[model samples]
Target: MSRHSQVRESSQLQRRLESLNTARELAEGVLPEQELQSVYDVLERAASRRSLSAEHTVVGFFGATGSGKSSLFNAVSGSELATAAARRPTTSAPLAGIWGEDGSGPLLDWLDVKERHTLPPVPGLADEHTGLVLLDLPDFDSTRVENREIVQRMVGMVDVLVWVLDPQKYADAAVHNDFLRPMASHGAVTLVVLNQVDKLSSADASAVMQSLEGILARDGLGQVRVLSASALTGDGVQTLRGAIRNVVVQREATTQRLAADVTRAATELARASGEGEARGIKGNAKARLASELSTAANVPVVVDAVQRSFKRESAKRTGWPVTRWLLRFRPDPLRRLNLGRDDTRPELSRTSLPPAGAPERARTDAAVRDFADDASTGAPGPWRAAIRGVARDGREQLPDALDQAIAGTDLKATKRPLWWVLFNTLQWLALLLAVGGLGWLGVLAVLGYFQMPVPEVPRTEGWPWPTLMVVGGVVLGIVLAISGRMLGGWAARVRASGAAKRLKAAVAAVAEQRIVEPVEVEITRLKAFNAALKAARSG
Candidate 1:
């Protein structure tokens, strides 16, 4: 390849590698572990192979059991590098044939090839194929399981694949379905050689080549070159040599192979992540969730307590001084609920409110599920499941969080109303007047009984001053007490309504922290994954 082309390839590879890393992180808890690990393995293998030498082009000769790949390996190298036979599974392990001065030791070592051979320079082909490293891999259809495994492992590491097929098995289902079809996108680094074409007449050879080409095209490998050659007769070997030499000279086989692998991986990951974009949760859905959580947290109960507490305090302020102290005998409603007090960390404090019953718990669970479902609408199945999982991740912590929110809320209940203070002062004055009038009457009665001289009492508007003071003070106090009770009821309602609003807001915050936040995080992850995949696939 030209220098500019090589640089472009390197840049694309870097971008693909970065994309793979991002996909790995995003798929951690969402996708199946095995699926993600497979992609990770692909990336690691590609990175390790590239870390070796970039000069040598490692091409493997792969075929089914009687395809004569070992013969073709020898023909390509122009030397007897591997034993060739018509029998099945002749090659057990991979045999490498190097054709350059540079020792591909590290590359072969990474490829795990133990048997090696060096080919002498061909008359006119030595310089062109200098950096080529050819391998005769074991039969992919080997009866021995280990031999088949060796082929499978080497398939991913090789820079290029050259499939050698005999006329009889060129169209074999296993070869086409298992290998050719899957590696379709790797056409730039793939070739197919029809070995043993010498066994057929010229017309038959052409017909067989034509039929194989059709099959390969259906396998999505239409761009892959199909050549007819014979290792035994050395016929058409020159053409195959030219193909391998061009690949070696260009030095793009490795790049194309890695790029194809990345494309396949990215495609698979995108499928697992879903195709649609995340629109996020709807506003009404969040409000409904908050309302449901409030019910479950007993916010209404706390609000009721606040109202009752206000009324009790109001009664103390406006009642007759003689009986105002009686209001204190009863406990404040909000205090009993462990609310209406200042607390630095309400999350740590347990509310005295009643434990949620079965109905409340069920409602909360259903609402959470509904919220996840609504948020995940139009998402893929796996992402929807992940969204639901996120919502429930901190479910056990929710009850405590909600209770803390209620307890930590400032209900404004502690501040007494100014009107209450004014009414209270009047009540105290009235009580004092009644007591003074009684004292005066008692003194006058005692003097009269003792036959001592008694002073005449003052009168106001033709009424005895002491008698008027006693009757008026008593009547005024009774009337004031009755009026205070009516006003206290109205004031209690206003305070309760305000408290309900504040408490609901606190409950909404709790819902956000415990449920909505987690769901949003998953949605964000999905968006990131989608963008990464897009970058990976971008032209």
Candidate 2:
């Protein structure tokens, strides 16, 4: 690969790695635990492997028993590194072969390949295969569990995988279904080889290769390169070396392998994350919930108390002063409910409202659930469940908080109307008139008893001045008192209606702060998470 190509590949790989990390973060609570752990494991292994040697290409040879994998490894490196004995599972542990000197110590250590050998640079192939690190991993189908585990670990760490198979076992289900089919995305860094092809005729060899190609194509590996080679006779050894040399020259197998891993992880995450962005709670849904919560909080009861309280206060302020005192004998409705402002009252005073009965409480609970369900409509199962939890949280605080809210509200009950003053003044003037007339009458009676001289008594159309003053004062006072009563009733109703409006508004505010906002917060978080996950998958 050219210098420019290397730079572009590096930049692309960096972007992919970043996306993988973002996907992992977004999928933390959403995806299955093990699936994300697998992604993290890949990233950690890739980082460690790259830190050791970006120049070297680690190619692993994986096959079942009797697949001639060790023979192929020896032929490629031109060294007898792994034991190619005719046994069930000859290779117990992985063997490493390095070309062009400085050993990939850290890389091999990370791969846990203890058997290491340094190969002399191939005569004509020295420059092309300079940084090759060939690994002959243990048989994946080995009877020993430990051997199979070693193969599995090495397979993930290697930059490229060369799956070697004999003519008989090339179509084996274990090799195809277990490994090759699943790793189809790594086609860029994968190669398949049919070993010991020298034993068959040209026609038979062609037929077997064609069959293998068909099987690989069905396994979602249609683009993967398959080659015929005989490790024993060195028939196609040069051709296999040429293929590996091309990969070694590029120095991009590590990044390609890691990129493929990231793609695989992101795909699984996308499946679990579901589709589309989160739609937050709707406005009408919130209003409906608030209405239900108002009912649950006994807002109606408080509003009714406000109206009655307003009426009681209005009567005291606007009625006839003499009899207005009688209105105070009946307890103010709001004061009895332990609501409204009292300067002498303690700050922590709770409203004396009754607890919600079963029917009302059930309606409130159902409304909260229904709101959550509606808000989370079409959301994934996990988000819906989360929304429901958000709605139910802090429910125990509702009753107490509501009572406090009602108590804290200003009912405007202390204000007296100006009309009361005018009526009281009129009554006072009438009383004074009656008192003067009575005193005048007493004076006349006294003068008559002693036979003293008296001034002529004033009269209006034959009615005595004292009698008219006394009777007129009493009759006018009575009419004014009746008018005050009628006016007070009308004013009380108006004030009560206004108070009810204010009280209902206060209740709506409480519902928003306590219930609606929390659910919306979850919706916002879900939206952010979905956006991040989308970028991760696309990148």
Task: Give candidate 1's TM-score.
Answer: 0.93
- TM-score of each model, paired residue for residue: 0.93, 0.85
Provide the RMSD of all predictions against the true structure, rounded to 1 decimal: 2.6, 3.8
Kindly give the stretch of ten consecutive residues in candidate 1 with the minimal lDDT sum.
Answer: 122-131
lDDT tens digits, residue span 312-351, model 2? 6655654445566887778877777876666745347777
List ranges where model 1 is wrong by over 4 Å.
Answer: 84-89, 123-129, 341-347, 444-456
lDDT of 1 by residue, 269-328 (tens): 877676986668889999999998988888888878988988888888888878888888
lDDT of 2 at 360: 72
Candidate 1 lDDT (Cα, 0 to 1): 0.84
